[model samples]
Target: MRGLKDKVAIITGGIGDLGYATAKRLFEEGCKVALFDLKQSDAGLAKAIDALYIQVDISNEEAVKLACERVENELGPAQVLVNTAATFIFKGVDATEEDWQKINSVNIVGTSFVTRYTVPQMIKKGGGSIINFSSVSGFVGQRNFATYNATKFAIRGLTKCWAYDLAEHGIRVNTLCPGYIYTSAFVNSCKVLNLDIEEENKRASEMHLLNRQGQPEEVAAAAAFLASDDSSFITGSDLLVDGGYLAK
Candidate 1:
């Protein structure tokens, strides 16, 4: 996309399937990329792509602040920030305090910390885009998804508020709400549970009007658009890369 060349972009959950895919796309568009994750990457994936990888626990404000500083010093100020790191804790009304803490720490507070630190870098660069990963669950309820869904919903709310607060600084904030995407984690979970992979996939496929899971690259494409000047006028919006899941 236009205006992405030589820009710096940071993606959280960088080693994950979707996050890595987005990093690759942005790199191909000529952007310097940084991957921030809680876990260390064993494969040297970021090095392979010539991107910077930082192990960071975004829930800790100080760690996030330092990490952002390092990125600025290394890759220059970030012009695009994608907050894809999240903790999935599925629970219902019976959720315990511990469950709430675990989910909120990473999904909500952690996201906030990263954004709080990165916004200044963006402002220094004159403008930027922030993509917060929400989910279809954020819009609709599902069984035993109260804890996770609550945080996702909060993400959308946060995006809108940030958009309003950052507009004057030329920052754009939006939520990326995706449906079930066929990812390595899905296949691995099926194996761990001894579930038939094809059968489980079929069950998930039925949830979307497309009759199949979305791909990581497809979502990455939308992310690139939001990060680029292509989405210059878009902000405080939910870009549904859900394959018509909510249309049904």
Candidate 2:
């Protein structure tokens, strides 16, 4: 809540369910928000939140570089970066080279590209917060999630290393690991798989101690705390927004 007003915050995958919720929260806290995604953002949604949107493929370093420059010139140097952009590729031991490339390009390399360009801007501001989105998968293994979970685990690794590397710059880095949330992604996956939505939801709910899935806003709230001065004393840590899913 404190030390967030007037600060510039950049959120990758900003149009996604979780990322959008975070942008809304940061905007409400008086941060000038910028949304970067692979596709064009809805004008109405951008206008509603009064945030800037740029279409970018984070895997392409050149594009990421340009977008970062544009954001700095327009919204000012970013003091906070939320790396929520990711590609989901669920595969097991049968995963091929292509599968590995697709997931790694966006989930790992792409995240690095975005951070590469954004870090200098943060330095200009004397320091900043970098929120890297990992997941419960990062902490544990899952069925048919080898490709995806590998990247999530790598995200946590990157956060820890970045925290150490960037600490002297006054920047803080941390991973935001969340449990299953009832998002459009969940519904769409159910539809695509022809699974009963209610049954699937219930199945996911039972995995958490709370007996329910988490919400985007709840995760957003945690992100805001990390972005705000309230988390000044925290860094190089994994903040779990899970519903005690890993407790068991």
Candidate 3:
């Protein structure tokens, strides 16, 4: 919690769900934040954080460049980076190239690009933290989610590599693997499928050791620690924010 006061952070995909939660948590800890998400999220979150809204599709190079430029011009190089924006299609290996590319672009390539631009800034700032979002699904096999599973698994490896490479520069990298949470988008998805929303969610909670799905704020707490000195000695770690889903 100490030393986070007035620190700057860039949270890619920050205008929604987990990102928004983490951003709010960090902000509460007295850090300055810059949020990036689909340009569509600008109006909604800009008011919430009272921070600049960056219309960045992390998968697009030009968009990322422009967003980071704006951050530097307006605030400063971020001392923390959280890559939370992700998308995927659920299907078998019969999944098309487009499906693979879409997930890969946002989940893998986009995460890499954000870290690529921001790591140097952290180094310049004399060290910082990066928290990436992975999933318990990545650690285990899942049905009907080929593309997403692959990217999540890929992120686990990327977290370790970045930690190794960035450690010497004082930049710590780690991943937060969340199992399931109640988010509006997910609720809408389940509803669209006409799934018994309440029962399905209850089943999901039962699957976890804690007998409940996690809240975004809970995951955000872990992220907040990693970003602050509370985790000074930690890096190259995958902190499972899952409510015991992987244990089962």
Q: Per-model C-alpha lDDT, please? A: 0.95, 0.97, 0.86
Tell me the deviation in Å of residue 240 in model 3: 0.5
* Regions of model 2 farther than 4 Å from truth: none
Candidate 2 similarity to native, TM-score: 0.99
Candidate 3 ranges with C-alpha deviation above 4 Å: 42-44
Pick out the ten consecutive residues of candidate 2 with the lowest summed lDDT.
39-48
Candidate with the greatest TM-score versus the true structure: 2
Candidate 1 wrongly placed segments (more than 4 Å): none
lDDT of 1: 0.95
For model 1, residues 126-227, the per-residue Cα lDDT tens digits are 999999999999999999999999999999999999999999999999999999999999999999899999999999999999999999999999999999
lDDT digits (tens) for residues 1-248 of candidate 2? 99999999999999999999999999999999999998788799888889999999999999999999999999999999999999999999999999999999999999999999999999998999999999999999899999999999999999999999999999999999999999999999999999999999999999999999999999999999999999999999999999999998
* Ranking of candidates on TM-score, top first: 2, 1, 3
Higher-ranked by TM-score: 1 or 3: 1
Task: Score every model by TM-score.
Answer: 0.98, 0.99, 0.97
